[model samples]
Target: MSDTLIEAGKRTIELEAQAVKALGERIDGEFAKACEMILNCQHRVIVTGMGKSGHIGGKIAATLASTGTPAFFVHPGEASHGDLGMITQDDVVIAISNSGSSAEVITLLPLLKRMGNPLISMTGQNQSPLAKAAHAHLDISIEQEACPLNLAPTCSTTATLAMGDALAVALLEARGFTAKDFAFSHPGGALGRKLLLKVEDIMHSGNELPRVEKTALISEALMEMTAKGFGMTTVMDGQELLGVFTDGDLRRSLDQGIDFNTATMIDVMTAKPLTISQNRLAAEALGLMDAKKITALVVEDDQQQPVGLLHMHDLLKAGLV
Candidate 1:
């Protein structure tokens, strides 16, 4: 029984893979035309479909929206029931139906046309009403379904999904969509934290920043480090950043038989330490920390003065690690 199931799964994968490959090869000037229409659209893209195509359409709309193109899924059935009002003249419509003859989706054609909206259609038959009516047609036709009985919508759906991804990616590149732009659209997730979070957003500043004067005793620097809980402290001179002292520096001083009580911060501090700009991405600061084998960095301003401190724990708490 297990052997039979495995064979069925493999067969389905092979057939669907072939269908998707064919779909990729079929991408041509028409695909470019569809991309151009969406790119030039001044407003949102309205994706509509029925049944299985509806599920794929919703995902496609989300992908487009998150990738810099504004889009939303509108059910074809709902659209005919006054939901058609959701679409406007400025919006572009993408109606999806594998057979190109879903009554619910087809019913919206005249209404969309009357609204003067540019219609893009995804269908199996180029001569189908929906295809002929579209300003640009995306052919998602498949040679056969992966279904053993050849009745299910497996291969066709896969092709439609791939085509949607292709359209979104093409528009993304044309619009010069960046990771930061994607992050703004997905600001609540871990990906957003990594891409949108900056050093200044979470860095320790003002009273939270650990600082000690260069002439202060090493024990005083240690006190500041302990108070800040960063295991490090910045050593400053009169109105100037002098250096930094870390737990590692304390360890080395102890090994050299230097008393923290007698040794001054200027004697034990590391001079010319690495500093980071506050506006830099947190992920970049993490990279620098990893490369330097350090746990923290002093945030500096353009005028070359220490303004804050950033610790690795802040990144961990922010879900950036």
Candidate 2:
């Protein structure tokens, strides 16, 4: 029985994968025309569908919106009552249906035509009413369903999803959307945090930064480091960064039997320590620290003067790590 279930799962995956793969070949003049219509649309793209197709339409709308294309989803059933007002003559509508003849969707055709809005249809039946009425038709037909009974909307939904992804990605490339643009739409996600967060946003500023002059005694630097709780201190001369004294440096100095009261910070500090710019992304700082095998880095300005300090704990707290 276990072997039978495994085979059934494998067969379903194979069928769905093939269905999605076939979508690439279906892209031709019709797909191009659909993209052209959307790119030239002056208003938002309104996606409408019923049942399972509605779920897929919602996801496609979200993908388009996040990838630099302004879009939203409207249910076909709701459109008949009052939601149709959401769509204007300037907007473009994308209708999804497996049979291309959903009753609720077909009922809205006359009103949509009166409004003079262009229609883009995605359906399994190219000759169906919805496709026939559309300005452009994107065929999402599949050979068979992944379900053993062939009644579920498995393979067809997979093909439709793939087609939607292809359209979104094509539009994304044409619009020259960048990671920074995507971050603006998804500020709460991990990628957004990595792209939009900077060292200055989370770095230790003001009195939180431990600092001591090169002429200061090693004991004095250690006291400052302990007070700051950062396990390190920046050794500087006025506004210029000289080096850094860390816990590791103290351990090595202790092995040398040097008196903490007599030793200067310069004698125990590591010269030319790794530094990052305040404007740089915290993700980039994480990479630099990981590569250097260090826990902290000095944040500098354009002139290489230290302004703040960033620790690995900051990245963890920001959820960038």
Candidate 3:
């Protein structure tokens, strides 16, 4: 019984893979025209479908909306019951139906036509009424279903989803949609944090910064490190950043029999410590720390003065990691 299930799952995956692969060869002038229509749309792209097609349409609309195009999904069944008002003359409609004849989806065609909204149809059958009526028809037809009975909507839906992704990515490139633009739409997500959270936003500044004078004893530097709990402290000369004395430097000092009470921070400090710009992304600061195997970096200004200090914990707490 287990063997049967495994073989059936493998066969299903193979069929779905073939269906998606076939979409590459099927991309032609119709696909280009569909892309052009959506691009030229003055307002939103309204996506609608029934059943499984509806579920796929929702995801497609979300992808389009998040990738520079403004789009939303509407249930085809609800269109006749006042939801049709959600669509406007300036919008373009994308209707999805495996057979291109879902009654609920097809019934809205006349009204959409009257509203002068452009129609883009995705269907498994080329000769279907929905396809015939569309300004541009996308053929999501698959040779067979992944279901053993060849009656389910498996391979066809997979093909439709791949086509939707292809459309979205092509449009993304055409519009020069950038990562920064995507981050604006998803500010609550990790990608947004990585892109928008800067070192200045998370770095410890002003009184929270751990620092000491170049003339301060190692004991004083250690006292500052303990007070701030950063396992490190910056050595400053006036407003200029001189060096850094970390726990690692302390250990080396102890190993060399140096006296913390008498030795100055300049005697034990690492000259020209790694520093990051305040305007840099916190994620980049995290990368620099990881690459250098350090726990913190001094945030520096244009004059090489220490403005702030960033710790690994800051990036983690900010969700940039």
Q: Write the per-residue lDDT of candidate 1 for residues 1-321, one digit (tens) a residue.
A: 999999999999999999889987768998899999998899999999999999999999999999999999999998888898888999999999988899999888888888899999999999999999999999998889999899988998999999999999999999999988998999889889889999999999999989899889986887788888999888888768888999899899999999766889989999989999999999999999999999999998778788999999998898888
Q: Which residue pairs come into collision in candidate 3? A: none
TM-score rank order? 1, 2, 3
Error of 2 at 320 (Å): 2.9
Candidate 2 total steric clashes: 0
Candidate 1 deviant stretches above 4 angstroms: 188-191
Q: Is candidate 1 or candidate 3 better by TM-score?
A: 1
Evaluated at residue 78, the lDDT of candidate 3 is 90
lDDT of 3: 0.93
For all predicted structures, in order, the TM-scores are: 0.93, 0.92, 0.91
Top-scoring candidate (TM-score): 1
User: Judged by lDDT relative to the true structure, which candidate is superior, 1 or 3?
Assistant: 3
